[model samples]
Target: MRKFQDYRDSVHFYGRIWTAAAILMLLLAPAAICVRYNAWPAASAVLKGLLGVAPIFWTTGIIEVLTYAPMLGTGGTYLGFVTGNLSALKVPCALNAMSGAKVEADSEEGEVVSTIAIATSSIVTTVIIAIGVLLLNRLTPVLENPVLDPAFDNILPALFGALGVVYIAKNPKIAAAPMLFMAALFLLVPGLSGAVGVLVPVGALIAIGVSRVLYKKGVI
Candidate 1:
């Protein structure tokens, strides 16, 4: 018990330090850019731009914290949020790693696996992105080629399709309602497709509600 407590304390201590440092570096970059280029926009204009997206971003951030924290554990949460791209990359990478390791989320082994997976994914993504940027001149035409357009457009669907199959197989009861709801919603109101980020929490809430009702009735 003492050793476990020590590990937990150390994780929180270092996680806090790294999270603060990451935030400081993020703020410093924009500050440095504004100072060097004298490119500061009007305060009101900046506020207006922020207002346009702040609600959705803030809501999603809160929802992500609630939904992912239990699965990610402390160390993973700190590093994942710092690295960003949670939905598109970090979360999926962590989940795959944990699944491969046969560890349940929230367990000690799960915490370690999640942290390692997210950190590795962050490093790999950074390296790949850096290389892509460096080679953009040569790669742009190939990336933009018509032949690759459909594959590129379907990447997210393909990824989610595979993931959904695995997860639904494991928890079909919990997955059923939300999957049907989201599909019907998109089908009925195609315009809502563009606001998928904002709708994530809506789907989450629906799933939670369904799960709670099922649990109360001993259905799941």
Candidate 2:
């Protein structure tokens, strides 16, 4: 708890700054894409927004950063943040108004640099979130049906499922059985999905476990 609190304190301002940067980047992504690809600016803007928010569709930074810490080494958390968030946002984010840089592969201190970039991305995300709140305030009165709020909730599960499948495919030996087992557990346990929000993970894990086990035992 203390460590988390400390991290929060240290990263708070940094996060806010990054979020502001991201909003600017998102706003400018369309123009850049239009120039680069000779695409329509409005269409490009929509695409850019979709891509910018794609990471949120797949996984929250909390989950991505947390999940990778043990997977990498001492610098795992920072690296994970970089890779995960970029995987979320893609190259359009780095080139324009958000203007964060990529980790140069040849640079020895790339990890430290990447950490800074990830922190900035978080800041950009925060700004976007604030904007979201404002948009919600404007839209709230018109949206009486909670079901139609935003498609984000549904899209996130689908995106995560796709990513999980990729991860499972890449590392089936270790990821397969445990994932399925946990998912089955999630299902069998009464009210577990509602309790722990297990549907997405459960489905992803099951697919991985089934695919790997079938492949391994020559069942498929």
lDDT of 1 by residue, 66-174 (tens): 8778768888999999988988788888888899999988788898899999999999999999999999999999999999999989978988888889989998999
Tens-place lDDT digits, model 2, residues 1-220: 3553455455555655665676677778867877889876476777889798755544544443443333222232433344344433422232221223434322323434444544566677778778878899776665556776566456557655766675567666667566767667767885654423224344456665677777888865
Stretches off by above 4 angstroms in model 2 are 1-68, 71-117, 141-150, 194-220
> What clash pairs does model 2 have?
15-123, 18-123, 18-124, 19-123, 19-124, 19-125, 25-98, 55-88
Weakest 10 consecutive residues, lDDT, candidate 2? Answer: 90-99
Q: What's the TM-score of every candidate structure?
A: 0.91, 0.39
Model 2 TM-score, 2 decimals = 0.39
The local distance difference test score of model 2 is: 0.52
In order, the Cα lDDT scores of the candidates are 0.88, 0.52
